[model samples]
Target: MSKITRIKGFADYFPPESEAFTFMENAARDVFSRYGYRELRTPVLEKTELFARSIGEETDVVKKEMYTFPDRKDRSLTLRPEATAGVMRSYIESGLATREPYSKLFTFGPMFRYERPQKGRMRQFHQINAECLGLTEPAVDAEVVAMLWQFLSSIRIPNLSLEINTLGCRECRPAYNEALKAYLDSVPEDGWCEDCLRRKSTNPLRVLDCKVPGCKALVDDAPALVDSVCEECSDHFGQVLAHLDAIEIPYTVNKRLVRGLDYYNRTTFEVTSGEIGSQSAVAGGGRYDGLIRDLGGPDQPGIGFACGMERLLLLLPEEEAPRPDAYLAILDEAGMARGFLILQAMRARGVIAEMSPTPKSVKAMMRQANRLRSRFCLLMGPDEIARDVVQVKNLDSGDQNDFSVTSESDLDALADFLR
Candidate 1:
């Protein structure tokens, strides 16, 4: 038998890393709230059709990356590859679409994708996703993007760049696909991967998302959707740009931008960082005009974005989240018992408390607490318990204070001594 380790492409965040991620999540949640977006939580697993219908069958996510499996009942289910589809499922199921014209919603949780292990990409990752349920206006799209920018700024993430574009509405999408396919067809099929060849038949635009060396060269001179956008799409995209400009949100027109999901209809954009490799996209979103009707809801337009927590952390300064300032050290069986009691009492009074299950020794616990950089050590022993007292030592000042132990009473004297 072999000792178990984490599967490739999956990661376990240790304490310090987990702390920093929590900070990032809290800031994202707070900023989402300020923008009038309330939270929505859904299950990590959903019916397989949810994603198969929402994310295009031709896309990488649906074709290869999704973690799908079966249950005891033999019904197929999948660990969500992303949030939008599941969120949409919740919206439709709850009948929230009929009550509100625009229901702003946000969700954060783990999303699973079965991709090869690599930098930036992972098998399991966390996303802070936000969705705007019913606004058809391009201003709504810009506002979401603005909120995303503000969130990154709030956390001091450096070198953020916004790449915006329009992928055309369903009414006019066929023509653009025709043109894109015409361009794709001009290139020899032998020069591309098998998936790209299949994409040529079902989803030609995904070839643009490919990093294949041969396909890259083939599409280098291909026609862009921006040049092919229909009149209504052109107007919609212009208004989105105008709204972004009016709000003074800096962005660049990336005519080549296209989302892997089939749901994106217009005004697609991705916020990227220069330093991160392969996973350069920190956040991305777009309009899904026909999605409501597609999901059997009344015709509702929507827009939103999802940010990767791990990738966002990469953009921040190297300084980690704040660690605990004090560790209450306990030694010996009697001292361990006393420490547990003290921890309960101190925690009730709003102190971050830590204690080992079994007391090692006074000197050992002191060293452990000091390595943790605890501000002070609360030392107790059989002798101290006998006198109904414990020693409070300030590691920094090398000063010690003694206090009687009791179930009720202010430890003001000990507090004053430490100070």
Candidate 2:
């Protein structure tokens, strides 16, 4: 028989690691809720066209990274590679825009993408996503950034930096696109990767986002989008920066920081930390005013961000193992019945308690108690039960004492002793 193993790019979180993830998630939820955002959940699968439509047909997410398949009845579906598209689809289908003027929503769960697994990336990844739909105010963008900043700070991630950029809207991006395309045409194709060559004719702006060194160097002299944005876009971006400044959020404007998505426009930002090596982008998002309308919804504007849980987990401080309040060790059949009663009573009092799964010698039980790091151990044997008493050992201080009880009925007395 062959041994079973986990699939590649997927992770298993055990004990203290799982506890650390829970702590981060709770912190995120607390921060998000404080700003009047409600939790929203959507299915992991959506129609194949949803991503293709929202994340640009030419982007890598749709071209090569999506996990798509045809379900029964010949309908094509894809496991969600990101949450923003699905959340927008739900907003449109649920007619949420009509019911409310603004929607502040958040969700956290698994997202699937078929990409070469690296140190902080996986086929199965999780994100804490926050979105504000039906609002076009620049202040909303600043608020989103502030909430995420507070969340990372609360979790104690070190050496943080925020990068901000603006991809001018459809109204002004064409001029920059033409200038960028001409520059791409001048560069010899021999130095470019196959993807960059294809993008030069297709979505040429994406060529700026390629990570290949030769490809990156070729675009070093390419045109900047900030210089090409129209007055309206420039003002909008200026207001976003102004708001960040008012709140004392430090940021650097990187001309080449194009996020790996097609829906972004006018204002894009990323939060990065040096702790994660190379892949330092811990959270990223921008305003997507056209995404709602493109997905067959109204012309509602939206702004949001998604933080990778796996990446943030890499920066979290190690957590200490939790200690149990008491361990019950029973010797002899008569003491077993009384042990059950005391265990229940201790638990009812909000004390963490456990018993050995099987009967064992005193030495073995003590070893188990030590391993559990239980504060105290309650021992019941034939002689102790006959005397209507139980021996309690303080595992931490190495102190021993005998406490009297009325056989199996003195739960109050046992609870008082443990407390």
Candidate 3:
């Protein structure tokens, strides 16, 4: 028989790496909660139409990356490639906007995308997502960006910077798109990548986001969308920048910072770090005032962002696995029975205690305890069990002490001392 292995692009997390993930999650909950953002968990699978509508059918995510398929009943379903669409679907289906005019939500979970795996990109990746719904004010955009900045800062990700741009709203975007399309059409087809060439017709703005060197160079002299935004969009963006300044959040206005999503409009922002190689963007998002309405929900406005958990992990320092506080060594049959009771007592009192299932020589048990990096080594034998006591060695300081276990109160005292 052959040994089974995990599917390619699907990663298995273990200690240290897993611990770093948890630390990032806990930091998200802490920072987001401070800004009145509550958690909302949605299923990883959803009707394929949800994404096709919310993320735009022409986007690369829908056209090439989604893990989409039909089920037994022949219904199209997809492993979500991103989170905002699902969150919007939930907000509409649950009618959450009706109850709370302003809904701030956050979620952390695995997201699937059928793309080539890289240092910080994977087929099955995780994201820490946040959404602020109902308010359309420029201040809302600024607040969302600020909250994201603070969360990333709290985790101490080094060498981070913020880049923001405005992709004019519907009323003004058509004119800029025409201008951008004209510029793209004039450029020789040989200068653009295949995707850029297709986008020149399907979605011209996406050409600015292409990572291909030829495409990037071609867009160097292209019309700047920010320069052509209508007064309303220009003012909205101005206010967003003003608010960010008021809060002391530094940002650079990147004319080409069009995020890889269709739902975004107006304010778009990204947080990047030099530490994560070519995939430098650790987090990004923007304002989507029309997403809710497009998803068959109320005319609610939303601003949110998502952190690629894998990318953020690349910036985090390696973490150590947790260690047991105490390891119990039972030297004989009698010690095994009494040692089990003591272990239970110690655990009941909130001590991180562990014991072997069966008895072993003291030398072997002590070696095991040292291997676990336990702070204390507890020893029990027939003599100690008969005397109603156990010896505890402080592994760190090389000190030893005996604690009486003749009564429950004594056990509590022993637990207190160990703790």
Candidate 4:
């Protein structure tokens, strides 16, 4: 017999840890809804070609990290490595464009990537995704970034720093790519890492994102993308910054922050927190003005961000699980029958009540109630049943009172008494 264990890169949230996940989901729902974003859910698996087409075959996610395989019918399906692609697919498949001009949406669930597992990074991870579609205004870009900041603040996440960058649109990115390529070609081959060497020819922009210290040193003085952006891109980037300033959102413009996706163009931003170790970015997103059309959807502008849940969980303060209002203890068969009816009636009245499942000693039931941190224990014994009342004991205060349980009026009085 072998002992069962969880897979290395997956997580099993338990007890207080699960509580933290709930807190994040609830908080995200509240904040997203307040900003007029409705919740959307899509399938965990998608067509493999979707990634190769939208995320780019040259990128790391499609080329090296996606969890892709052929199903029984000989069609390729993949566990989603990221979310935006799937959302676009759904929008197109559902004919949402004919129905609505734009959609403000948010979704959160598991995402898979076959990368090495590290602290705050996982092969199977979770993300809180928010997107605003059909709008290309620079002000929307600023609003999306501000919404992300507000969410982090609402969760009590600490020490966050905002990094913003502009990846020139189709009109200007080609020249910047050529300039970047020229610089990479001028550098000695010895300084480049194996990944950078490949990306140099395939996707020259990715060379700037390499983490190898030697590779980074070689690209240190490469031409900044911001400098190569055309007039429209420059003006849009400037307005994004101005809007951030108008709202008092502090930021640093990072010239080297080319996000790890091929779909992004103009206005890329990341929010990093000091608490999450070297995997510092808790949230990131950018404008993908061309992706909806690229993915066979209506041509519309979209901007969004995703927060890493495991990383955010690391920084969230421990939250106490809520306690039940009352526990019903049944002492004998006669009392059990009466208590069952009372339990349902109490619940119908919106009282959070539970009963001992089986016949147990009064002392054992009391202990169980205490373990659950219930506020009160309703004791139903032979004497209490004959008297048509219950012994209500306040577990915290150790005070006891007799409450009538004979009729609906009595139950209403009991409910009022408890309140």
Prediction 1 TM-score vs. true: 0.90
Question: Candidate 2 regions off by >4 Å?
Answer: 383-390, 401-419
lDDT by residue (tens digit), candidate 4, 1-419 = 99999998999989788888888999999988888999999999999999898999999999999999999999999999999999989888988778887889999999999999988889999999998999999999999999999999999999999999999999899989999999999998878999999999999999998878898888879999998999999999999999999999999999999889899999999999988667799999999999989988788999999999999988998777878888999898877888999888888787888888887898999999999999899998889989989999999899999999888998887776555
- Which residue runs of candidate 1 sit more than 4 Å off their true CA positions? 329-338, 356-362, 381-390, 400-409, 412-419
> Can you give the lDDT of residue 333 in candidate 1?
73
Shift in Å, residue 323, candidate 4 = 1.6
Model 1 accuracy (lDDT, Cα): 0.83
| lDDT top scorer | 3
- lDDT tens string, model 1, 1-419? 98999888888888667877888889988999999989889999999988888887768888888888899999889999999989888998899977876799999899999878666668898999999988888888888999999999998888889999999877788898998899899888789998899889888988888877777788888888888888988998999999988988889998778898999988899999877866689999998877777877778788989998878867777774454444666656756666777677666656665766787887888888877777778877777777767777777898887777663664544444434
TM-score, cand. 4: 0.95
| Per-residue alpha-carbon lDDT of candidate 3 for residues 1-419, written as tens digits (9 for 90 to 100) | 99999989999998778889999999999999999999999999999999999999999999999999999999999999999999999999998988987999999999999888888888999999999999999989998998999999999899999999999999999999999999999999988889998999999989999998878888999999899999999999999999999999989999998978888999999999988777799999999999999999999999999999989888887666777889999998867777888899999999999998989998999999999999999998888888889899999999999999989899889888888
* Lowest summed lDDT window (length 10), candidate 2: 406-415
Model 4 worst lDDT run, 10 consecutive residues? 410-419
The full ranking of all candidates by TM-score, starting with the best, is: 3, 4, 2, 1
Model 3 clash pairs are none
Candidate of highest TM-score: 3
Question: Per lDDT, what order, best first?
Answer: 3, 4, 2, 1
